[model samples]
Target: MKQRGIWPDEFTFAPLLKACANLEDLEMGQGVHKHVLALGFGRFGSIRIGIVELYSGCGRMMEAKKVFDEMPHRDVILWNLMVKGYSQSGNVDMGLGLFRQMGERTVVSWNLMISLLAQNGREKEALALFHEMRNGEFEPDEATVVTVLPVCAQLGELDLGRWIHSYAKSKGLYPNLVSVGNALVDFFGKSGDLETAITIFNDMPRKNVVSWNAAISNCAFNGKGELGVQLFDEMLDEGVRPNDSTYVGAFACCAHAGLVQRGGDLFDSMIANHDIEPTIEHYGCMVDLLGRGGCLKEAHKLVETMTMEPNAAIWGALVSACRTHGEMELAEYALKELIKLESWNSGNYVLLSNIYADRGKWEDVEKVRVLMSGNSIKKAPGQSTIV
Candidate 1:
């Protein structure tokens, strides 16, 4: 078109800009921005929205802000995009600020803000916002219900989750939407109410991979490893394709139950039949399983054979195994690898020192203490927050 002495319109630029954003080609995005400016298209709302999205996608928040500030009129969609960009980039406060600045908000705006806060571990603030939203006469939608339910589950706020469930039921929103039902399943699963999770799952008119993964993984996480294993079998029997997460959940179950041979078999089957390449988490689970069974050498070899470099968790598992089995030399080796990887967690130092102390190696214990003190490393105190 340029060769023909013709210019592309906003419709032409929007898709091109979106392509640039998807590719993260900052230079191309800038070129598009320049073209938009040269064509005097900045005043067009649709073009401006695309520009904002392009800049935000390229991580040029300042540029996006410039576009936002110059917009003579804005809509909820524009506000939603800006808030989403901030939240996605870990600037939750900025996202909330943008939301508060808006004179009006849609359900999308409210859900985005609430979900962002809840997903990012600001459960207390999320709950407060939910309550405030209700007080202001904003009825919670399916998205809002789904978003905050997991927060309640994670914080073990079963009562809050139950209240949300009740509200969702009263609003005639339960068991219909897969998303809402899935969230409820996850919430109950995380709260150690496997029976309730199962009931919800069974009652769901539809089930997705997320619903199954959540229920199974929660069982493993909550120390019902045997039951989790059983569920894994049932999931397979039902022909629900297990993904990498499912394998991890099953491996975790085997690890917790000290089912070494079974764990190894399942690990092999994951590669053979499931065709899901084992990730670092899966490798870590195997190490934990073998280590707990006094198969330190096997665990060490497994780490060595891993396709990717073993992370701190894998080494930590070996170190823990060594400590459990009184394999001081192996523990020392694992500790050295951990330290080499720059894993500065004070607990690692403490664990190694305790191992030495257990073996009556006073000199080694003293050395570890000296190193920890020299580095000013202190163990973090365990604290629990109700809200």
Candidate 2:
């Protein structure tokens, strides 16, 4: 069009910069910036948003802010973009400041800030903000419902979550949006309401991979291993391909219920049938299953031969199994591996000392005590939060 002597307007560069931003191509965005300035389009609000989008999308927050500060008339969309830009840069404080400064707000704006808070480990603040959003003029939308349900689940805010579930149903959001149904399933399941979780799962208008994952994992969590495994089988029969997380939950159910042979079949078929490569998480679950079933040697061998290095959780599982099965020597070895990975964890030393004590080796127990003293480690007392 330019070669044909057709001039580019605000429409041309706004999306071009958006594309650059989406691709995170800083150099291409800068070139577009130069074109915008040469064409005097930077003065236009829409074009300025594109400029901000390009800069912030590429993680250049300062440049985006400069463009943002110069805008004479900022709409809620621009404010939302600024919040998004700051959140993308992991600058939650700046995003919150911009959010608070907005003269007017939209659900998109609230959603942006709430998501930034939740993703940054500020669940309490995110929940508060959601309440504020509710108390105010703006009604939570589908995005708000999806984003906050997990935070509610994390915080054990059962009342708030139930309210949101009702709100979604009232707004005709649940089951209509597969994501809303999936979120409700996850929230209810984690909240220890397996009955409601399963109800939602069955009532979902559609079920995706995530829907199945939430159900199977929740069943595993609630110690309903039989039902969990049945769901896994049903999922396969329904021709929905299980991903890495699906196998993790299924293997965990096997471990919990002592279905070692079933776990092994799933592990083998994960590669053979589904073509999904086993990650370390899958291997961890299988090792956990073998260990729980008293197959110490097989579990140990699998840990040593893992494609990726076994992490602390794997060693912890092995040591826990050893104690349960009275395999003191293997427990000692697994504890040592666990210690190498987490030397500061006093529990590993305590476990090692206990293993020695079980074996009538007082001297080894004293040495483990000395190791703990030398490292300035203290056993963290077990505490439970009622909420």
Candidate 3:
């Protein structure tokens, strides 16, 4: 603009700075900031916000804080931006500090705090905050419903999730808002209410691929692979084209039920019919399916011939199958692959030791114990929960 003899005015720098922020181009953002200072727009509220946003988006929370502190006066909006920056950058403590300091909290502020807590695995705290928000006279909005619903799902808080569903209905949220409806289905399915989940799915005014995927996976999770297969067939009949996730749900069904031929045919169809290239996850599922079906040689051959590098999940599945069938030689081979893939993971080592012990190979078990001690590898203690 300068070269073209067009002088940049105050309004000019605001959009330019915003562009830099959106692109997360800190170098260009800094250059724009320098230009804003040179043009006497450094004190501009909009420009400062843009600068804060740019630094924050790039994960430079300290720089964002600096720009924020330099402002002549801070408003709730600016404070919210800073809170978001700290939260997203994994500085949850700093975010909580700023949130606590806010004089007036908007719905967005509450949602951000709740989401931040949930993101950091503080689900119970997030739910508590949601209760607090309600006590403070703030009605749950769509964003609040979307944010807190996942927390309910995670904790298996069926009563809370049902209340949220009721609230959404009261507010006329579901059926129109597909996301909330989908989340409801997922929450119900995960909370061991597959019947309710399927009912919700069937009653949805409109259904997307996600709806089908969730319903199918819900059935697969409860050892209803045949029902999952039925769901997939129905999904196809409904013309909802399946994605990788869809295939994954279908393959999971095959694995649990040991439907080897169906899994193999579906694996072929993924490429031949759908044109969706197989990801490592897809390969892992196929390996698991073959292994669980007792076709150890075929499973091993699949892993060895995979175009992508075989991951631990693929090898681990084989090891598990070998352990089940007492295929000592195959178990050893799977253990080798597992160790090669994840040398630090002590679960596979312990599994191999157990396999040897089960076969009365005390020398091999002792060798495994020595290797573990020499490498400083320790198996994580197992924990059982009644719930």
Task: Tell me the TM-score of model 2.
Answer: 0.89
**Residue lDDT tens for model 1, 59-119:** 6788888889888888888888899888878899999999999998877788888888987
TM-score of 3: 0.91
- TM-score of every candidate relative to the true structure: 0.88, 0.89, 0.91
* lDDT of candidate 3 over 181-240, digit per residue (tens): 888888888888888888888889999999899988888887888888889999988888
| Deviating ranges (above 4 Å) for candidate 2 | 1-10, 360-387
Selected candidate, larger TM-score, 1 vs 2: 2
**Candidate 2 C-alpha lDDT tens digits along 1-387:** 879999998889988988998899999989989999998888887789888888887889899889888888889988888898888788889899989999999888899899999999999999999989989979898999999999999999999999999999999998799999999999999999999999999999789999999999999898888789999999999999999999999998887788999999999999999898888789889888999899999999999988889999999989888889989899899999999999988778877877787678888877887787788977668721111
Off by over 4 Å in 3: 1-3, 354-370, 378-387
In order, candidate lDDTs are 0.84, 0.90, 0.86
Q: Count backbone clashes in candidate 1.
A: 0
Error of 2 at 113 (Å): 1.6
Which candidate should be chosen as best, given lDDT against the real structure?
Answer: 2
lDDT of 2 at 189: 95
- Which scores higher on lDDT, 2 or 3? 2
Better of 1 and 3 by lDDT: 3
Instruction: Please give the lDDT score at residue 227 for candidate 2.
Output: 89
